[model samples]
Target: MRPSTQIKPISLLKTQTAQVIRRVCEDREPLIITQNGEAKAVILDIQSYEDQQDTVALLKILALGSRQIAAGEVKPAGEVFERLRKLER
Candidate 1:
């Protein structure tokens, strides 16, 4: 199991916004923002966030493809390309 990572409240972060953001970005770490003593949002580095989102999208595509294959709805790679080639003619 992965260890838990904790972050301070947003109000406390307001004091050293630049420093805190920089540290989190460099570390690829997530910061839990809180309001009224409750967790409100999470802040993450843009690149790290993008990478995670891309991974999710790729996984979804693979899952859909797997489902289609399981249902016998997929075409062979060569046949798919041949059909496309005819369409281009």
Candidate 2:
């Protein structure tokens, strides 16, 4: 689901933006901006932006784990015990 509705040209922004921004701020939706009839940028609420960042971080960590597993860098659970036993001795 889209977080924000679309707001057209920047010219209409001054009058329309405050209202649109207020709605997005209250409901946590993003405002899609346009320029010369093409998609320009997005205006996001801070909380939504922060959430996106956290999701990106999680994806990066998962990708690193996947790469390590593909590189055969993984060990079995029992091998952990063997390593600990050797250390104790």
Candidate 3:
């Protein structure tokens, strides 16, 4: 949670949608939208949202690699590189 300025009630959001959106985009910070005093939604700038998605996708790939290693479903790096080099020929 941030200061009161960064948090807006659903009513205010409806009335001041443009300003709220502008603030979030310019500040590069998420705006917390609340209903009944409970946080309900977030407004994130496009770049931050895309970056988060990219990071999550990378984490998924890393997790898959870890699981493969633990299950011994792996190949030798030398063999893999040799196959790549031959493919490049």
Candidate 4:
């Protein structure tokens, strides 16, 4: 499910720049800026942006893992566990 997006016209940003930014920071939701009735830019809070970046990085890692498995490059789980168990001895 997608988060609810707030849309505001470019004129609003031009007129109420600080208010818009304050609201975005407080809400932690993306604000879509539209130009001539078309979407153009998005305003996001710093924390949300960082979280999104982290999620994207994790997704990339998962995708790489999937590709490795598909290419028959995965180690056997039993063998890997046996090695770890030996290390614990």
Q: In terms of TM-score, which candidate is strongest?
A: 3
Tens-digit lDDT string for candidate 1 (27-70):
88888888887888888899989999999999999999999999
Pairs of colliding residues, candidate 3: none
Q: Please give each candidate's TM-score.
A: 0.76, 0.72, 0.88, 0.80
* Model 1 weakest lDDT span, ten residues long: 1-10
The per-prediction tally of clashing pairs is 0, 3, 0, 0
Q: Which residue pairs in candidate 1 collide?
A: none
lDDT of candidate 2 over 1-89, digit per residue (tens): 45234555666666676877777688786777778877788788889999999999999999999999999999997999999999999
Q: Residue-wise lDDT of candidate 3 within 1-89, one digit each (tens)?
A: 36677788999889988988888889988888899999999889999899999999999999999999999999999999999999999
lDDT tens per residue, model 4, 1-89: 14344988999999999999999999898999999999999999999999999999999999999999999999999999999999999
Compared with the true structure, all predictions reach lDDT values of: 0.84, 0.80, 0.91, 0.92
Please give the ranking of all candidate structures by lDDT, highest first, separated by commas. 4, 3, 1, 2
Cα lDDT for residue 36, candidate 1 = 84
Top-scoring candidate (lDDT)? 4
Model 1 C-alpha RMSD vs. true structure (Å) is 2.6
- Deviating ranges (above 4 Å) for candidate 2: 1-5, 77-89
Candidate 4, residue 63: lDDT: 100
